[model samples]
Target: MSIANQIIKQFPDLLIKKDEPLSKYTYTKTGGQADIFIMPRTVSEAQAVVAFAASEAIALTILGNGSNLIVKDGGIRGIVMHLDLLHTIRREDTCIIAGSGAKLIEVSRFALSESLSGLEFACGIPGSIGGALYMNAGAYGGEISDVLNSATVLTRTGELLHLERDQLAAKYRHSTISEKDLIVLEAEFALTLTERQPIETKMAELTEARESKQPLEYPSCGSVFKRPPGHFAGKLIQDSGLQGKQIGGVQVSLKHAGFMVNVGGGTATDYLHLIEYVQQTVKEKFDVELETEVKIIGEDA
Candidate 1:
């Protein structure tokens, strides 16, 4: 039997779909499909799927909230797992324990409700806890590395491991999790007890700033390029006169040059081509190399 067939046989009760359209899940609303899409509700179920894939030598891709990712037009092979059902949050004194699939916005709101202060910067981030930790997500001068105390992860071989903050080696849109291909199961954040009003005020301020600056109305993978050393990606793109540039249905967000928005019915090929155009244009104009911050995966159509 095929790997997909084996997965179904092993987990008959699990939510599994074949040739699932990844476009429906990604923020860009583009991409082809996944050979097998599985939504695992429990950590044990997730582990089992991982172990099965490892045993079969099948590719396993963790699809987080799809905030900072772009799936290719040809779609992903093997098993694509989404942990949305794992969304849960709990508080222990000044610490917040969030499941990997918990949305960052919800986590930040929970912190505000509990009068915890440290996650205010994540209020506007549109990714899940696992995705955030994977990329060391940051905004408004705060980063995941600043507050993450520890995390529970499933190794590539399906063994559960607990790693401390120091062990994560999180820095500037990177973490050890990506290097080791570990799947985050849960994260513990060390926050401070604070007044509710102040936390709400900060969240509001950050949200307002994000709304004013980002093109949130469109379908985008958030910031496309990382900030080059001593230079902002948006500023560089804007300075290169690449704002409002379009390739197929994808356009450089007029609101923020850092974003490449899917105006309508865009393809991954369009997105990738536009990225290359912008990088070449920016390099020619400013002589600075632009690096992508968004994670592009899967085969090309």
Candidate 2:
């Protein structure tokens, strides 16, 4: 039997789709299809999929929140798993317990509603809770590592682990979760009890700053490059006069040089080529190498 057939046989009630276009799920709205798409309703179902993929030697890819990611035109091989159904958020004392699939922005608002501080920096970050933890996502001088208390994850072998903040080894848009291939199921964030008005005010300020600067009106994978030491990627790109430069349907944001926005029907190939061009131009002009913060995956057309 084929792998898809076997998968159905093993998990009869699990939600699955074959050859589904990933463009429907991505922020950029430009991606190919997923070979075997699975959306697990519960952690157990997610665990089973992981275990089965491991045992069968089938490549498995997790589609977290679908931001800061680019899937190539040829689509992905093997199974693509999304945890959208696992989203749930609740409060426990001074801590907020959130499922992996919960939106980071929603979690930040939830904290504000509960009169909690510490998550104000994340009010505009567009990523799932798990994706935020995986990448140590941050903005405006605060990072996920700052408020995270602990997390529950699954190893490739399907072993469950409850790891503390230190175990994550989060630093500047990076985490051990990627290195260890751990699947984040849920997270606990330790926040401070504060006046609701202050939290709301802080969030408002940050939101204004983000909206005024970022190219929020376009379909773009947030910041395209990581900040190099002592130099901002956007500044360098702007200094190189590469802003508004176009490659196919993708162009460097006229508003923000760090972002590559799709003016119209942009493709992953276009984005990749534009990224290369920007990196090359910036390197030649400023002697600084631009490394991508956005994760690029899938096969080429």
Candidate 3:
């Protein structure tokens, strides 16, 4: 049987898109086609799909909002399972139950409307809840771990488990989840209710700061590199005179040294080249190795 037929025979109702363009799924708007893109409608269905992939030894990957990721020109291999359809939020008294696929923006809006104070920092973060957990995404001194209560995850071996905040071993853009090959299903966050006006004010403040600092007008991942110890990545890059640098259609933003923008017709190769250029320049100028903040995946160019 053909690979397509093989997949269909196993997942009767699974929605599979053949040769789906990776550009449509990434914030960078650049990538080759994925062999098959799958989205399971329910968590159980997702679990079942994952198990089957493991049993069949099919290569698998999970796609979130694409906010913090870059798919290369050669594209992602095997089946890319997106759980964006699983987005749902519920308020259970003092805690919020959110599906892993939920967007941080939507969760922030809901939290603000309900006077939930702890999520204000996430108001402008452009990643899904699951992606946020994986990276421990944060802004304005607050992080996912600050409000996270617990999460349900599925191990690669198909075992389901619950992990609390303390158990997550979350740190700056790193988590125990990163160390393990586990898929997050859902998460619970404990929050305190505050006045609506204050919540609105804080959200607006964060938004304004983002607007002033980021090159949101361009298609780019938020920050290209992480803050190296004792120094800011953006400042170092700027100081190295690498801002406004270009590689094909990709340019290091004039507005922010931290971002690499798809100015007009940027490609994945262009972005990676720019990233490499920045890393090399910074290393040469300051003897500091700048690490990328955006996750680079898929095939090598």
Candidate 4:
């Protein structure tokens, strides 16, 4: 039997598949394939998967929403776990306990439904609760650091842990919580009750800003680089005259220099080559280096 067959046999209840096209799973709509793709419905199911992968020494990676990631055209080896099946949300007195797979926008809407005010910045982030917390994702001058309470995680060895916000080393586009195979299963946030009008206005303003500033009409992994202090990365790239540049099917967005968009049917190689080109051009024109914000994973195409 194949390794994928073995995996399904071992984890009977998991939604398992073989040779699944990764394009269906990613925001970029590009990638080769996944050897083993599994979506576990319950926490116990997720834990069981981790244990099985560890026992077999399989290469395992968990996926939340794929808003800020790029998978290579070469399919990933081993198991690719998805937490979307674990989506659940519960409201506490002044806090929300959210499942990792729950959409960030869903959480924000829930907060609004309760007349809670603190999640306004997350109203437009197109990712799961886990992905947002993983990168300390923020917008409109607010960050996860403001409302994060704690996380329930599963370690590499399949042990369960509860860690506080500071313990995760939450910083810009990173967290130490990911150093191991620690998967975020759940998170809690503290919020406050407020009137409806101001909250609605803030959400509308942010939505408009994102639509106007980002290349939302195309396929992309969102911002390509982390902000380098004192200057905007997009302005620098535009000033270097790299806007609308193309590599294979990838093109620097004329709409937003910060965005490296897949104009149509672009490959991971195209996107990568374009990134390198922009980086090289920016370095030659200015002394500053651009650091990538989106996490690029899987093998080279």
Off by over 4 Å in 2: none
Candidate 4 Cα deviation (angstroms), residue 293 = 0.4
Residue lDDT tens for model 1, 1-301? 8777888999998999999999999999999899999999899999999998899899999999999999999999999999888899999989999999999999999999999999999999999999999999999999999999999999988999999988999889999998888999999999999789999999999999999999999999999999999999999999999999999999999999999999988999999999999999999999999999999999999
| Residue-by-residue lDDT tens digits, candidate 3, 30-106 | 98878878998899889987887788887888888999889999987778889898899999987888998999989
What value of lDDT does candidate 1 attain over all alpha carbons? Answer: 0.95
Those runs of model 3 whose alpha carbons end farther than 4 Å from true positions after fitting are: none
Instruction: Work out the TM-score per prediction.
Output: 0.99, 0.99, 0.98, 0.97
Superposition TM-score, candidate 1 onto the true structure: 0.99
- Candidate 3, after superposition: displacement of residue 64 in Å? 0.3
Model 3 earns a TM-score of 0.98
Question: RMSD in angstroms, all models?
Answer: 0.7, 0.7, 1.0, 1.2
lDDT of 2 at 154: 95
Judged by lDDT relative to the true structure, which candidate is superior, 3 or 4? 3
Q: Which digits, one per residue and each the tens of the lDDT, describe model 4 over residues 149-209?
A: 8889998778999998678776776676655547889999989988978888888899999
**Predicted candidate 2 versus true structure: per-residue lDDT over 144-259, tens digit per residue:** 99999999999988888999888988889889887797999999999999899989988999999999999999898889999999999999999999989998899999999999
In the predicted model 1, the residue pairs found to clash are none
After superposition, the stretches of candidate 1 with alpha carbons farther than 4 Å from their true spots are none
Alpha-carbon runs more than 4 Å astray in model 4: none
Q: Which number leads on lDDT?
A: 1
Q: Rate the local accuracy (lDDT) of all candidates.
A: 0.95, 0.93, 0.89, 0.87
